[model samples]
Target: MFCGIVAGEVRAFRVTDEPDGVAFLDTRPVFKGHVLVVPRAHLVTLADLPPESITGYFGLVRRLAVAVESGLGAGGTFVAMNNRVSQSVPHLHTHVVPRTKGDGLRGFFWPRTRYADDPDATSYAERIRSALAADPA
Candidate 1:
């Protein structure tokens, strides 16, 4: 499903697209403006990513974290990924979610909620989309 998003065969509201990877807003986001950064190639796990490509991939992840914070006016961001354990998709992707104090986001284990509706989801995606444009590398 997501590989299609990376391949451009499917439509995904993208935040940043680089030679090594691409960052797009998560359809089911932990928070509004939450984004997922993934490698262009198909890699099941982080260990599968060649050592040489790690830095570049993570560099974009770092940039997205900053964008998540500044763009969404968040106090910070929650950046994480699951390897085979809780990995929803079998691809290597990093989640960068905007954070704020007392936002009810507990630890890594917390409740998940969907956008209020389609319009709400669209607004959240747009917020992150525009934010990415404002904060560039």
Candidate 2:
């Protein structure tokens, strides 16, 4: 993790001007366009982020939801933070997942399946990237 280094790891789907931040659909998403909004800052959870940072973080999440809905044709989106049970990687990040009726995503009610191959992963990533780029906040 690149603490205080803004740009973070992936540059492909970066949305905002914050250097230590980026967002895009997860390569192995739970659904077709499941997006992750992460800060480049190396923090364990949202509680570790400053108030202003948290505010900006969620603002980006909202922008991502709109982009996913308009550009990717998702019926709606889900914004979530897993501070306790599902905190993987120990970073202060949020998920903006696009959802549709009968998409079979049970949210936190059921476990998520990981993608099996690179090609499928790449396709989902590209789809969200294009959508985000076309309608960036």
Candidate 3:
């Protein structure tokens, strides 16, 4: 349970319990209906994951993307995996961010700016949670 995010039982769009670890969604998200497909086993980079797990992980990501796009009404979605360079957490996790025009979020091209405070983070997380709960994909 990293960061206490997994405090109790929660629902996931998809779940794959591998020998090494498990992967699921981030109930709190940056964008509406955003999902984080992560391995429960701690691995810093994609290269560290087992070959079969890597393959299955991406497969789940693809499915999650389709769900986010269809269920969340996103115009598009962004899927990404990170190594040490941009990895905030040591665990290997993939981000499935749902995108829309005029959401005030620029694409990956633009530099990211920090939110004002906890309220901003809470607001964003709440919006995504509500959307996902209302219409899960």
lDDT of 1 at 92: 93
The sequence of per-residue lDDT tens digits that candidate 2 reaches over residues 21-98 is 677546546666677778766777777888878667777777778877876688998888888576765677777877
Q: Residue by residue across 37-120, what tens digits does model 3's lDDT show?
A: 676565678888888786666765666676667656789888887799867777678888778877776555523444455565
Q: What order do candidates take by lDDT, descending?
A: 1, 2, 3
Candidate 2 local distance difference test against the native: 0.67
- For model 2, state the Cα shift of residue 22 in Å: 1.2
Question: In terms of TM-score, how similar is model 1 to the real structure?
Answer: 0.87
Relative to the true structure, how large is the alpha-carbon lDDT of every model?
A: 0.82, 0.67, 0.60
- Candidate 1: which stretches are off by over 4 Å? 116-123
TM-score of each: 0.87, 0.73, 0.61
- The alpha-carbon deviation from the true structure for residue 56 of candidate 1, after best TM-score superposition, in angstroms, is 1.2
Pairs clashing within candidate 2: 6-19, 6-20, 7-19, 20-40
- Sort by TM-score, best first: 1, 2, 3
Query: What local lDDT does model 3 show for residue 124?
Result: 49
Give the Å shift of residue 35 in candidate 2: 1.4
